[model samples]
Target: MPPLSRPPRETRALFRNAGAALPTRHAALLERCVERRLRGPAQVLSGHHNTNHVLRLGLLPAVLVGAVPFARLKYRVPRETVEVVPRIWPREWDVLRVVCRFLPEVPRCLAVLGDNHSLHVYRGGTVLSDRGPHGRIGEGLMRQFAAFFARTAGIPAGELPPLPEDWPADGDSDGFLRRLVRFTEERVHRPHRPRFGTLFDAVGIPEDAMARFLRGLHPLTPRPFALLHTDVHRANVVVRRNRIAVIDWELALFGDPLHDLATHLVRMGYDKEEQARMTALWAEAMTRAGRAELTAALHDDLGAYLAFEYAQSVYPDVLRAALALPPHATADDFHAAAHRIGHALSRAREPLRLVDVPPEPHLIDALRHWHDAQNNPATPR
Candidate 1:
């Protein structure tokens, strides 16, 4: 699809009519933002699921205008948009502020309007779209990315608000992996029926193996919580001047640094060889940065965590495809999508075994109970 363009007169009119609150101060910032734009023709940067109307101007690079409140705007003159949430704008602003102080690679903050939003100017560069060849560099880039996060994670949590109250408990390796595995068993495997041709069947998750596999696995625990960019995927990274520029801070939380690494590894779709290469580089970087012990355990924790992540994705993928269906879509549409995701999850399970990490003892016992219940007609409920 082509990049999106500015809204039509009617569209703008509709926005105005929709009663979006236009901040008085934002009006001045919007004017200044447009004034700072390059003289060349501007184009709308599309393909965003967020509520921002993103445009690339010749002089300014990228500008994002929030469509909801009508006046909130952010400038990405030097880089791409990472994330925007009004509630945590202060925290994000503080993070960017600190990062810019230490890292020259980050874009410069031009201005922040009110307490809720800001604008930044970044130098532009190429973004890797294809997933195959970039795998090697992507892995190294992720290590560099981890190093960047480790710096922030080292910050004393006592100085912050004890991490956000809603932050995922998985910041600890054990909790993170256990939740992932449990989510898979309860949400994906439990829903399967013989007649349905569920994901397990499609992806070939062996009915017999599921029990033993889950039983033998143990969650690896890592000490010390660090600042984590929880959503570090291929899409969130940009390659500029031989260095990787990480974006998307909305999912930033205080947690296990390896979780971020694992999330990137899984999302980037690196093969086994590539994964090992990346993990080694990441471990080296962490070790050099004085996080050797945590880095060592991360290698083991990643395996179980990945299984959990893959299984977790199954439900969301099926749900997303289902929600995309036309209102009149038949029951078969939902079933087909669910089956596809289930199979994908099953295939994902194979890789988890390859990691050579074991599951937690409680989880092993639970899997055994579940296994016996599946086979025994009179098994306890």
Candidate 2:
């Protein structure tokens, strides 16, 4: 390997290859992380899919660097995605390389330890979730977000990675949205039904919920496609030096840019007024980027995407909420879990065409019953 830099293609190949070995220091750190022996200047963070540990790599053996460098190692696990976004291109590492080549605010992906693990330059900052910034953000920050959205939308397909044969042709907004809806139904729900099916039924989600939702979507207007950071919620955003940087490109995809906007608008927990403000900002930015066609369906198509987000999210939200119930959960725990599941189901009701959501008491009873069954699978009903 070149000491300084390698071509992007070679680098991408190296990162994608699961057989490749991590550097000695990185390898040691990964081993410690796997063994849960990580000590000194280390922090462990977990999401549904990956257990991430941050390590201070210090310095190169021969180099005279003054600073203690840091990198985050991600260990893969059986993660779930509620995005329902199509991943036609490569995942996070490549997305970062391509995106950061132009937009530097995005966290740089250093390397992939192996198939399921990755190393990223650990940018120092507090995650937005930790900050819990409520209400509208200032104009400057909003501009930065708008620019990030536009820049990502303008990325050329030629520069990234090869898309699958099933990917819709450019400007096929209809096809793109259809693929997403299909993914939520066929890819997400169908596969996990055997496991979460009962939980879903108890929550009043019918097997044909997505089918009914899809039928109500309006005809999509043609819009140019682009790369999207589909999971850009507060947790995935970092606030450093008065600027916000996006991380976790694992759910990144190439699709209708509005889908990206919709995801961000929802995930950020923006209020109704703030959502309108953001929509305006995004429209202006897209138009300025000479991608006016991308926003043509803003009035109607955006709602479809938002509905889709709420619709698909219910499956994961219900399953995750139920799974989160502790073995010996208290009444308060069950109440909290029930409230959470009720909210998700309530938000999803319109799109999914649910007849009625169970009351909190009913939800609590159902959850307890589900948890009991999970613990005592051998005992017949």
In lDDT terms, which candidate is top?
Answer: 2
Predicted structure 1, TM vs. truth = 0.57
* Most accurate candidate by TM-score: 2
lDDT (Cα, tens digit) per residue for candidate 2, span 233-281: 7888888988888877777778888889988888888888888888999
**What is the Cα-based lDDT of residue 28 in candidate 1?**
71
User: What does candidate 1's lDDT look like per residue over 118-154, in tens digits?
Assistant: 4544335655543333445644565676576666655
Clash statistics: count for each candidate? 18, 0
lDDT of 1: 0.50
Instruction: Tell me the deviation in Å of residue 225 in model 1.
Output: 0.9
